[model samples]
Target: MFAYYLNKTLMHIFYKNAALTDYLKSINIQQTSIGFVPTMGALHQGHLSLMERSMLENEITVVSIFVNPTQFNNLEDLAKYPRTLDEDVKKIESLNPKIIIFAPNVEDIYDGKPSSESFDFDGLENQMEGKFRPGHFNGVGTVVQRLFEIVKPTNAYFGEKDFQQLQIIKKMVAKKNMGINVIGCQIFREPNKLAMSSRNELMSPNEKQEASLIYETLLNAKEKFETNSAHAVTDYVQKTFKKNTDFKLEYFQIADEVTLLPCLRKNKNKKYRAFIAVFINKIRLIDTISLN
Candidate 1:
């Protein structure tokens, strides 16, 4: 019961915007360094890795667990996106009881209007995941910028699992001159090498196990990329998926990391990474690997 009472009394969670602001005022955070980690809240080991780093690096860590509605392109997706607040809180508290959680409702975040705000993330708004999802980054920019405005964190954390999204957030911070350091943490994966994602919760045990092929394929493609043409590497990946027959391959491209454009040939001086999106039934999974 000491632990229970400790959690009940010491846990710092804010569900309302005004309450959080008032609490921040009381604490006078001008001197404290805050690290922010935002998530849609299907707490996995992957999410914890980011939180763990934040807890170690800063005086205060704010982990926001809201499923931003604007980022989803479909109502079906928005409705189905996992929200595991109670479990998420448990996982976070396991690391450190003092960590702050900003888990606001739509009204708390957007004043109940629930519309997206747009930002220019250079040409990054037009590439890779942007080409497929359409306005997904605008919605991402909208919510992240609003969170930055609200939390005023000195530094923020993101995982490299969503590599394109990572690039976009960096661009948004630069364009706005937000002065906050956005740290991109390494991708966390399962024992099978599948990148951990909230969507993995939607898959069955067999499907989740089978999804490991996606990363394995990317690894093979990376090896092939050393001697093969970029076109040849993608074609090899395309055919590999065709052999599987269960996974619906969306798009696979090897691109320059900074420009976010497909690299037809190696420049030798520049770095590149392979990005892929695949579907296991209705669930979509994305992963990236450094090719160079």
Candidate 2:
């Protein structure tokens, strides 16, 4: 039997809109404070950490494991993206929180057409992940907006690993005047300091070891930020990764945390962070670190 948890007790699974709505209705969802954590399946320690935090703070926690195809800029990525629904459910069941797993199919959520709604994130979507992946944030904004409407959670949790996406979602909430609280969780990492990511599943043992260099480089850049200009530090990171053959450095920038615009020089009044995206063994890996 497939066992899940609700209210610190065991329960069965709920899928699609009708079943989920009926289940929530039976539980009087209106009176409960819901915490939502949306994922694209391929659950890992990082995902579990988000759920753990949600359970600690809210009466009911909901996690969605839909691999939203709209968010992928590349067709191959969407196709190759890991889908471990069975394993993911087992992980969620282990949490034993009053959690709802909204594992909806594309047609059910999208109504046969993915949202083409464009959002103006005040240029936040124009850099980094934006600059590289065209139409990615619009897809993100659309799906997240729909999810918010459907789940209507009091507070939603997101990891800071996708620092840019976290910021964009927050901006979308504000701009849309959505009353939901968006919580930014810490970036979970591996023992070697490589940030935990679903994409890490695609890496071979050697690629995984070499991927640690991404975090190591970020740490080096962090130290450089202490005594160097923003441009100099960025240049240093670029050159260092250029020397390594294991990964292709896509783009690295030291930018204002709020605006996400590349900083020409560090400013005392603003918080700066180093954002990086690298292609290791053809898998795109991203990581960020605070410069201030």
TM-score of candidate 2 against the unseen true structure: 0.95
Q: Residue by residue across 1-292, what tens digits does model 1's lDDT show? A: 1122245656888887777777766775567888899999998998888888998898888888899998899788889899888888788888788778888988878888888887777787787788888889989999999899888888899999898899999988988999999999999998889999999999999999999999999999999999998999999999999899789999999999998889987899999999999998999999999999
Candidate 2 segments whose C-alpha is farther than 4 A from its true place: 1-12, 29-31
List the global CA lDDT of all models: 0.88, 0.87
Model 1 poorest 10 in a row by lDDT: 1-10
Winning model by lDDT: 1
- Model 2: which residue pairs collide? none
Global CA lDDT computed for model 1: 0.88
TM-score of each: 0.96, 0.95
Q: How many backbone overlaps does candidate 1 show?
A: 0
Task: Indicate the worst ten consecutive residues by lDDT in candidate 2.
Answer: 1-10
